[model samples]
Target chain A: MTEEIIIAGFGGQGVLSMGKILAYSGIMQDEEVSWMPSYGPEMRGGTANVMVILSSERISSPYLKVFDTAIILNQQSLDKFQDSVKPGGVLLYDPNGITIHPTRTDIEIFQIEGNKLAVDMGNAKISNMIVLGAFLKIKPIVKLDNVIAGLKKSLPDRYHHLIPLNREAITKGMNNLKPFLVAEMILK
Target chain B: MAELKLMKGNEALAEATIRAGADAYFGYPITPQTEVIEYLMEQQPEKRTGMIVLQAESELAAINMVYGAASTGKKVMTSSSSPGISLKQEGISYMAGAELPGVIVNVVRGGPGLGTIQPSQADYFQSVKGGGHGDYKLYVLAPASVQEMSDFVEDAFDIAFKYRAPVLILSDGIIGQMMEKVYLKDQKPRMTNDEIIEKYGNWATTGKKGRERNIITSLDLQSEKMEKRVHRLMKKYKQMEAEDLRFEKIACDDADYLIVAYGSSARISQKAVELARKKGIKVGLLRPITLFPFPKKALFDLANQVKGILSVELNAGQMVEDVRLSVEHKVPVEHFGRTGGIIHTPEEILEALEQKIINNGSIRHHKTRESSIL
Candidate 1:
């Protein structure tokens, strides 16, 4: 099975790093993966996005017309990529700044309160991990142990001590997810 | 087994540089390829393997530095993009004329001038057609994936030293910027100056010791002497064409149509080939890994089998010229390209294959439906 995902948010929100971590987790689980970031104009605090694919077989196109999952963090990304989520796919977003809620009835939509949770945890940088935690809780593509291992592998040695804090944020985000009004399916 | 790590194509190339036992890398920073020098600087190969990694003032200085290191019979490399590579033409021509061995990488961006920093294959004509002025041919290797970006570094050095000529790893921006899993080469110690002199010093510019002065010059004042040097260069290029051609044919054994592509275009065309196969169109892909060798024999053989061919690239049809030359117009060779850093999707290529090559005549009936009804 192949899972094509798009992680989009503000540039400094660790959008690219989030995708990189998931790709590393795929490697940790012995799966093939690819990570492609939108590296042109969005690199300077604008809306940033990255395409990530994890598959049991070799991945062909790193750029996809439609994605199985879209983790959106801002209103711009929500407006841009709301229609790009495939039917019966998952669209996870944090409701920190998104004004217009997604209205599609074909896919599963979840509003994850990662920003509030990060503020509550007194660390604002691990919000991406919280969204990642929500993604893992909703669709268990990779194990939590593998994700921790991926963090250990991806993070530099100086950032090693922050792994436990990031793990806590992920657990908090996983526990505090709010699904849409009508849920037809819960992938797990 | 070698360790597998996730790396960008440029980063993998840099890591592979240290692992390949190359003695020196002199590079200038350019978009989509700055990561190569960044990784090399971070690694500090000077401390690890006694290799030198110096950031030059410009691409010209970098290439000339590569030439100087290579003149001493040391394995050397430099990386750049399309515009920067243009500035390196003079140095490249000199090194090639002098027959120095080195590797040059062009993570090509779109161009006729200072083009976009995004991925583009517009350098196809410039690279395979000999960008520098001379009768010299540089072995050009096109890498489609990040893994090849890592592995081809070794192959480029080996081929360069074997023929005592410059080799180019011609990759586009997509492969350079995109990240993928790659297996790195095993670390090998950098060759000392004495080792280089003893092993490859026959024509090298190492000090003339225990022998007459070994001159490494490309200048011949007399026209007749220059013609003789040209003949030797031509002869060596001919030998390389005979032995070093490499191409990959996928699903072409029993196919009706063929898609000729290299590097990133090849990757997309492979997907298109599969999609066409599912539709029972019998399409296939022919990817040329070595562009200079041109894979003329393989294309000619396939031309005898396939009804038509579609050459897909990210440029405005450069390699298509080589394709037509290879098949000698045996089949209808069509070109599909997106210039100025525009990359066509797989669906677009598949549509072109269907419209321009497959279903236009052989796969579709051109007879009037009304006449058949009448």
Candidate 2:
């Protein structure tokens, strides 16, 4: 199956890096993946976004008019991409950054307190890792071991000591996502 | 043979230049092309190997440095994006006028100004028609993948030195940023400065000592001499046209419709071909790796066999004109594309091909619009 995802937030919110990690995960799975960033001036402290397409077949156009999933890190991202989500698709937003509830009833929305969870895990910067954990829970196209391996492969050698902390953050986020998983299973 | 590794187009090009035994790289950093410079800098070819890499202040300065390096019979290169490439036109024209051999890579981004950092094929006219001033042509190679990105650098340098002309690698941001597996050449092509001096040292200005005074210029005040010089350049172009044309054909031999495209556009067109085939339409693609020679003969031959031709691009209709010229208006040549930083999809191209070729509707709509607008 082909899955199109858009991760959007402010420049420093790790949205681009999140997209890159997803792309790298797709590559590890031997899937065709393309990550296209919004290279406009909006990249300078403004809202930054990236479009990623992971497909079993060859990907035609990297641009996405309709995305199957959207990871919104802030209110601006929620407002910007809320309507672009396909019907019956999923949207995962950060409750700490996005306060406004989505007005649409056709799509599934999951709000996670990513910053609080990462802070509890001892690093606020690991909020992206928390979101990624939630992403893997919702879409299990890649295994946890594979993602950990990808992280190790992508991270710089000097930062190798932080691997366990990152893994802890991912585990904490995954643990916090149990209620959503139970609700999704009940709906299914 | 070397092992294959995944690489971005920019990195692949840097590696290819090293393998091609480039004496020096003089370039400025620009979007979609910055990795080439980064690779050279971090790799530190000077200390590890014996290659020279310098980050210039501007595209103009970079190209001028290339001119100086090439004049010394050294294989040199520079790279930039569209806007920066616009700034280097003066130097390119000078290089062409002096008949110097050098390589320049234009990793294209969308723009007339500082428009956007997105990928675009908008510089088709500027590249094929000589972006610089006066009458001159560059040996232009359009690469679609990381594989071609590496391979074409060596090919461009070879054609440049063989013909004593400037060679251009015309690529867009998608090709520059995307990663793909590429197999590099095992051994680097050998070109020594001392060897070049031994061969062409008579004319090179090596401090103007111990030799007859040599003048490197493009100026000819006399009309007769100028006209003769232009003719000589024309002759070289004709020779290139005869000998150096390169292209890739996919399922075009017995097809009823032909898709003429290049660079990233060709990749999408290949998908369009597959979609059309599944729908029972005999479709194929003709991708030109060399934009200058235009692959006129190959396209003209295909024109006689195909019922129609579709010119696909990321710009308005630059390559369409060349296709029409090649076919001599024998068969209907239609155009389809998106401009202003928007990329054309395979579905869009398939829709156009179906409506025009299968349904046989108004194929000339875009052609008329292009002519009227131009």
Could you say which candidate leads in lDDT? 1
Q: Looking at candidate 2, what TM-score does chain B attain?
A: 0.93
- Model 1, DockQ value? 0.62
Question: What's model 2's overall lDDT?
Answer: 0.83
Q: What fraction of the native interface does candidate 1 get right in terms of contacts?
A: 0.51
Per residue, candidate 1 scores C-alpha lDDT tens digits across B1-374 of 79799999999999999999989999999997899999999999999898999999999999999989898889999999999999998888887788889999999998889889878899988887779998888899999999999999999998888788889999978889889999887898887768766666578877787878877777889999998988887887888899888889889989988999999889888878877888888988999999998899999999888888999999888899999999986678889988877778787899988788776774233234423656
Q: Per-candidate TM vs. native?
A: 0.94, 0.84
Off by over 4 Å in 2: A1-4, A26-33, A53-61, A64-69, A75-96, A99-113, A178-188, B1-7, B180-190, B194-215, B221-228, B251-256, B271-283, B304-307, B351-360, B363-374
- Per-candidate clash tally: 0, 0
A51-165 in candidate 2: lDDT tens per residue?
8888898775565567899988888888989988999898888877555657677877776778888887677898988888887778887777777776776678998898787
Q: Tell me, what's the RMSD of every candidate?
A: 4.0, 4.9
